[model samples]
Target: MKSSLTTIAKHPSISLLKSCTTMKELKQIHAQLVVKGILNHPHLQGQFVATIALHNPTNLNYANQILHHQCHHPTLFTLNSMIRAYSKSTTPHKSFHFYSKILHFNNLSPDHYTFNFLVRTCAQLHVHVTGVSVHCALIKHGFEHDPHVQTGLIFMYAELGCLNSCHGVFEGVVEPDLVSRTAMLHAYAKCGDIEFARKMFDEMPQRDFIAWNAMITGYAQCGRSRDALSMFHLMQMAGVKINEVSMVLVLTACTHLGALDQGRWAHAYVERYKLRMTVTLGTALIDMYAKCGSIDKAMEVFWGMKEKNVYTWSSAIGGLAMNGLGEESLDLFNSMKQDGVKPNEVTFISVLKGCSVVGLVEEGRKHFHSMRTLYGIDPQLEHYGLMVDMYGRAARLEEALIFINSMPIKPHVGAWSALLHACRMHKNKELGELALEKIVELEDKNDGAYVLLSNIYADYMNWEKVSSLRQTMKAKGVKKLPGCSVIEVDGEVHEFFVGDKSHPRYDEIELKLEEIFRCLRLSGYVANTSPVLFDIEEEEKEDALGKHSEKVAVAFGLITLKGVPIRVVMNLRICWDCHNVAKMISKIYDTEIIIRDRSRFHHFKKGDCSCKGYW
Candidate 1:
């Protein structure tokens, strides 16, 4: 039997292990090694563990069982293989158990490879303390200077939100290579230090797709969408390889700016280059289109996707809700469940928002309750807020208050803000004041709540209260956010603030707006000045209403984009006066106007709105 084992070890079944395509073949070889009495051979044992650990469809459980129970003594190579595999696995925290085992074995010591995988595992775990301990181990082992290990440290620190530590690790490198530098770039970008990221990116003698992606994603996430798009264009001009990450980041930028023309160009570029439409890219496209007020195009993308995940379904459902197609959103949510995609927390938020948008009060209640009871998802603050908004939008103010009072957790400012909005809409000064009180207790600088309550007072002709509210806002140093609108024309995004005249062609836009309102008046359109919070002269109030950001953007769109739908994205809700004007303009000019505000989309066509005047 010893002679037979020697012969098998000399010949070795390592080749067979390497060629394994499935777990069954691997198990057969493992059993053969056992029968041949060479399974405990150090070299053969390492090979067997590696094969199982690095299999195409890895069987970590089998490898783990063999390491813990079957193999009486495992080599450092065998344990490192297991650690590397577990580091990349879903249960990365399990890698620590193997690291503990490595520490116990005085005969074996961790190498740079071990530290690399262990640092990555710490990153995956997102446990800062564990990551610091691994860093210390790497330093103690004198492998901290390894470029790969340093890169891993950078990533781990970045993931743990220890940006200063990331910088320290990066600075420790004598002459960082491109990989290490790129890792540092990613660290800075991930930590929201885009300035440092860009500096690193520009200083690099050579830049790869990963570096470019980190920079672009940083810009997109930091609300610098214009800069993100600009970086993408520069990336193309620099002749860099564009991949799925590039497309997704650019789509996010387009979504933020409501740059549909550019977004459409991105979609065309994806098809023109034949880049595989991954689920993430597909979801980003849906989000961009839906947010840019092209819901039909969003639905088209949704239907064309061959694969759908929970996020994809949620994006589509939320898109429908944003476009004010509430019933369709609910139907799609049901279909998502039917397709076996369990709804996550975000899915329920979209579902509830859909209910609130269309005033599906009972349906919203059912879904909200189902979150905790049926799906085991605890009702988060956003869900509770959506329920309050739904009831409030339906004019069930008493029920909304009751629901807020009955929350299992402390009521957030969102719930109170929703009730305050409903009070402003219904001109309920008493409840609006009550909601304002609650909101002030939570967030003293909640400008929206104060604005809504002030509007309510104005609606009731309580000019003295409105003045007092304004004085209070001043005393509290709370200023209302200026309304801003973005419009895309000829692939360039133009922004407008309330009463802005910053555009070079502001004169032309103003002239065009004058012509539009002239035609609108002829068509019996009168400015509804009730939304003006300040008690000013009626004529001055009308003037203020006309200079709203959306009107300026729409006027510019009409000037530049003839015969195309004028899509406007705003930072605030559309006032009743603006909604009426948009409807009249759609009829008078025979045009389609789509306005996406902070709340929902208003699709105005032929003297009607898709919202049916519900919002």
Candidate 2:
């Protein structure tokens, strides 16, 4: 029977004989081939090899063993199948080495699919040199013109941050396809060139869902939030069906722009499309509400979700921290731990911020230590800055300085600024000067640092140093960022600058502010004009403080909104005098005022800020 099987397997019709559609039929044929002992024959062996490799049958390892012992040298198709299997397998490198063996020993010419498998492995491993070597091999063998090969090459070069190389490869192809164009767009976006990405996207003649998603994600990631939303609108107008990823990007852009109306539209679109339940989309929704100053809405979205992950928890935690529900945020952190979801670095940062806001020094210290001992996550620079800010605000200047020295990474301007502010708070002029020196060394153009340092020197009557610092700033062309604040009243965002009269209603705002001051004075609010220049007359100092950006914002809130609490969001820290006035305004008007300053939310009601006057 074995001799007869060998003869029939070599009969040349064996390739046609083994072409069975179903695995059951294939196995029956295999049984017949075994009865005749033709499975070991070379010509018949290739048939078994091609069939099993492509069929995805059970007992594939056994089939592989049979082919390995029989052929000693496999055919091109046989090698290609094995290559693909290995490419899809966990051990791609081993499959790649096998293909090399096929090429070296039997001179088996690899096809398009073979190189595809090999290059994909290089991409997965992020082995740029290996990928380039494979590209050279393809060029040497004259297969570079294959579109599939070009696509793979584009992806490899892009991932390597070699956008120029990716463009070079794409240009070599005559009329590149959608996949290659999308790859170039992704390359540009990943390399932080959003303009070039948009150009590449525009040049493409045709686009699929993947291409659109790539471009949208690129825009979203490159801080082109408005552009991303505009593109989404255009895609919708073009009748392109929105996918989960597209929704995610646009929702994130809404979050960044603080576009509450657009965010609501996105939320409605998600419900309309029945995508509200998707984890990615749900997380984006939560983030959108949180960032749009609607923490209650964010919580609603969070609680509505049936599934949640670290990002979901982080978004809610960070949102609550931002909204000044510090106690609630900390409670959620505890709940997250109780649910067995390990806190990541970002989660810890949010909770730390909550601690900083509420002055939970002991809890903050415990979490800081637990970062490494419990979670095994080392604190990064931002975390360090937060800790320094925390300790500094708690009036632990020495401990703050000690922590600065103990940081694993060199202190950046942000960390130094934290300590500098702490020094000013505690009147540590010497340490403030030292921190300023480090800050200038790290970031010479830091206007805030210069201003803070100058103020510290002035506090101690170091007029000469202040003059020198001012002259240096003028020489270096370092312009200070003008203080600004935004107050939303009656569905309009009113922006104000320190001592600015740019608004068309500037006169009305001024008159109303004067009235507010008179009312405050009548209610026992005294102006602390020390933060303003003493060189100015006493009345002028009062006038300047009244025209400070935050004061204008609060004044507008009081005059424009009727019978409601006002929320004022400022981009800078509230000065001591301004904070005092806010407390007084809230008390006299009998209205709540929520001020989100540079650091945290200060909810003022009846002559009290959430910080307890410590910040």
Candidate 3:
């Protein structure tokens, strides 16, 4: 025991052995030394107990023995070690108590490392007051100029959402290094202040890939996809090579832009650049292709990746489900389980989406229950909403209502919206009224909910209720959101809205759509013209229904894309008449049409919709 203590005192890396990072190995060594009667050595004992406390399964009894039996005032190294150990302990409050005791111990001075550790501990515990106090102390102790201390301060204030304090710390540093600057940039970006983050990036003498990534990510998060892509182009122009982090951000931009051409360019760029096969970058690529309306391309990328993780499967499954391949998604989930890839919360979200699409009531119920039973994951509110939506879509209104009523948390507008849509489908006025009441309570400004309820009343031929609802909407000044759709052709996005004649080619577009409708009428495509919100003559109603936003967009896509398969993406649900017309358009034009509506994907191929007359 005495010889080991002497050996440790002379060794510089002895503390490394005591670090929690090496706890398991250290425990084995401790066992060996204990057999040789070395656990009683005072110096080694303090170090050993401190190491154990820092690690999991803290050894409090052994820690107390060394604190009491050791010298009257422990060494600075010993005190710092104990402080770090306690800070990471289950009782973090005890860490500050130990810090207070450090001042009482003579011959010990807290170093920069000690302050940095204290700041990180405060951040982890979310003790903002204590963290601020530590920041003031660092300045008082003339340690504010230290780069490591400044970096820690920036991270702490950022975590607390105190951007002003973070900026002050960044400016006060004697000479900010790259690490400190990067931390400051990240601080601003994370706090939702991307403008300030870009300012910092522009002011830097040189920007590393990390700094570039931070700004790109910030722009992507703020939904400025154009700016993010522009920055990517600027980085290349400035001779900064794109790496995995940069690629991920750019892929996210493509998803938002629906820039399939740009995404394909990026895919080719990745192969040319030969960035290492990282899971994160691969997952981002899969997600990008999926969202850009290329499910087959997404699957190709998913299968090509050698190292597939939970996120990889989740992304591919989510893409398949979103593309109306619900059964395929569930099959992939089962295969993932067989391959021993444990599904995460995100994976469950994809699975739930599949259930919602296919109306798989039993499978949905089983997976929802397994979230708690098999995986021990407590269901979140989002999961509850999805479950309710699944049951509602299946027309199992009783189960859906029971689930809604029994939610541990208050249901959101989405849950109630699901019930309202179900009510519209099943013509259940009682449930519809109940859902409308809840919807108003949840969101008074929900114009869509009001419109849906009014439509329901109209469907029931309840003219008085429909008129009353419209009067209320007008009195409250609640304006309904206009449904819109967009189609991209030849590098330009052409948008359309109901009864809109804003396009330069409106006359030609209208004639083309009418011509398509004639063919549809011949092919048994009856006009289900009930969705139009108007009180007008029969001829006007037909005209209004024929000029729906999606039809305009599809007509534009067909004229521009010619004989090629056209994909039109809408920001709202596709009305029944539009769905039927899309089918007939595909058959008459001998072209495939893919539409992504609010509910799910619809692939109209050769007079057949992939939804199988279900959705």
**Candidate maximizing lDDT:** 1
Q: Model 2, 1-615: lDDT tens per residue?
A: 787667675654455445556666666767777777666565566667666765553435645776667567666667777766665554556567657766887566777877877777666667778778888888887888999888888887877778888888998989777777888889899888988888888888988778888888888888677678888888998888788888888889876655566778888887888864688888999998876667899999998888888899988998898777778899999988988788999998899988877778889999999999998899999899989988988888889889999988998888899999988777888889899889989988888787777777767777677778888888887877777777655434467888788888888888988888888889887876655533567788788888889888888878887777676666678877799999988888888877767776677889898778755
Better of 1 and 3 by TM-score: 1
Which pairs, if any, clash in model 3?
none
Candidates ranked by lDDT: 1, 3, 2
- Residue 211 of candidate 3: its Cα lDDT? 78
Greater-TM-score candidate between 2 and 3: 3
Question: lDDT of all the models against the reference?
Answer: 0.89, 0.79, 0.79
Kindly list the per-residue Cα lDDT of model 3 for residues 1-615, writing each as its tens digit: 677557865544345555545445755666665576555555665566656655553464445455656435565556666667766665555666556666777766678877877887787778788898888877787787888888989998988989999988888888887788889988988899899889989998889787788888878888777788888888888888679788888888877766667777777788898976699889999998888778888998898889898889999988988887889999999999998888988899899988888888889889999998999778887788788878877889999999999988889898898888888877788898899999889888788787778778878778678778878878888887887777777655566876779999999898998888788777776666566556666678678878888889889888889876687767778877788888888888888988878766788999889987655
Considering every candidate listed, which one attains the maximal TM-score? 1
My TM-score estimates for the predictions, one after another, are: 0.89, 0.72, 0.79
Per-model tally of clashing residue pairs: 0, 0, 0
Residue 284 displacement in candidate 2 (angstroms): 1.9
The order by descending TM-score is 1, 3, 2
lDDT of prediction 1: 0.89
For each candidate, C-alpha RMSD in Å?
Answer: 3.7, 8.4, 5.5
